[model samples]
Target: MKDRYTDFKEDPRFKIANREALIGCGVAVINFIWWFGFAYGLGSKPVDTYTYIFGLPAWFFYSCIVGTVVIIGVVILMVKKGFKDIPLNHEGGDDL
Candidate 1:
């Protein structure tokens, strides 16, 4: 009997993948907090007076429109700065 499972800790690509995964998770968490906080936190305010932003509620504008733009920019920046391109054939690996 032999240990069949490979240890990912010894693989060079493991660190890169781990870093990218962490960045992706962080982005997801930030987006979740931003949207939820705006939708529930701000939308729950008193409606005594009508407040409109571009014919929509301020909460909707900030949560959906503005948040989307900001998230897009953040994703682009993360990909450019945090990711590296490794050639698939460098180690005789099949190109998928």
Candidate 2:
């Protein structure tokens, strides 16, 4: 059976918004996994045995610096390509 809010759910704006939100969440999850994997997986080693890259520990460089760069690039790409600029007005009738 059709729900009362079916029309609202099927609207293109909602679809666009849902897609954008999903994209954002997906990126966040990917970034988190990347950072956690490097920070813990590689960083678990003894400090004396740690590898260096550009004068920083390999895990620190990858997890903190590279992860930051990757997430920023993803966000910029999403904003330029994936996100939409939807209007804020539902209607004058719905205004307070």
Candidate 3:
């Protein structure tokens, strides 16, 4: 039997995977913070029927509509600039 244990940190695939995961986590954390701040922090204020934003509550407008658009744009930009495609398989080499 041969030992399969090896230093994975030195592998390119490992590094790429880690980088991608960190980027994903960062996006998630930002979204969570934004949502929590708007939903709980700002939206907790006393309700007023007189105030309207786009025919909706100010909190809903910022937290759902605007936040979604901003998050979409952010993800698109991150994917376009932050990630490199790795081939799933290489000719005469082991499958990824």
Best by TM-score: 2
Clashes of 1: 0
* Tens-digit per-residue lDDT, 13-89, candidate 1: 76788889999999999999999988777688887553779998888888898889989999999999988886546
Candidate 3: where are CA atoms >4 Å away?
Answer: 1-10, 90-96
- Evaluated at residue 73, the lDDT of candidate 1 is 92
Clashes of each: 0, 0, 0
User: What C-alpha lDDT does candidate 3 achieve relative to the native structure?
Assistant: 0.78
Ranking by lDDT: 2, 1, 3
Task: Give each model's whole-structure lDDT.
Answer: 0.83, 0.89, 0.78
Estimate the TM-score for candidate 1: 0.79
Q: Where is the poorest 10-residue window by lDDT in model 2?
A: 87-96
Candidate 3 per-residue lDDT over residues 21-80, each given as its tens digit: 999999999888877777666677788633568798877777788889989988998899
| Tens-digit per-residue lDDT, 1-96, candidate 2 | 688767655656777988999999999998999899999988999999999999999999999999999999999999999987777567424655
In model 1, pairs of residues that clash are none
Return whichever of 1 and 3 wins on lDDT: 1
Per-residue error for 60 in candidate 2, Å, reads 0.6
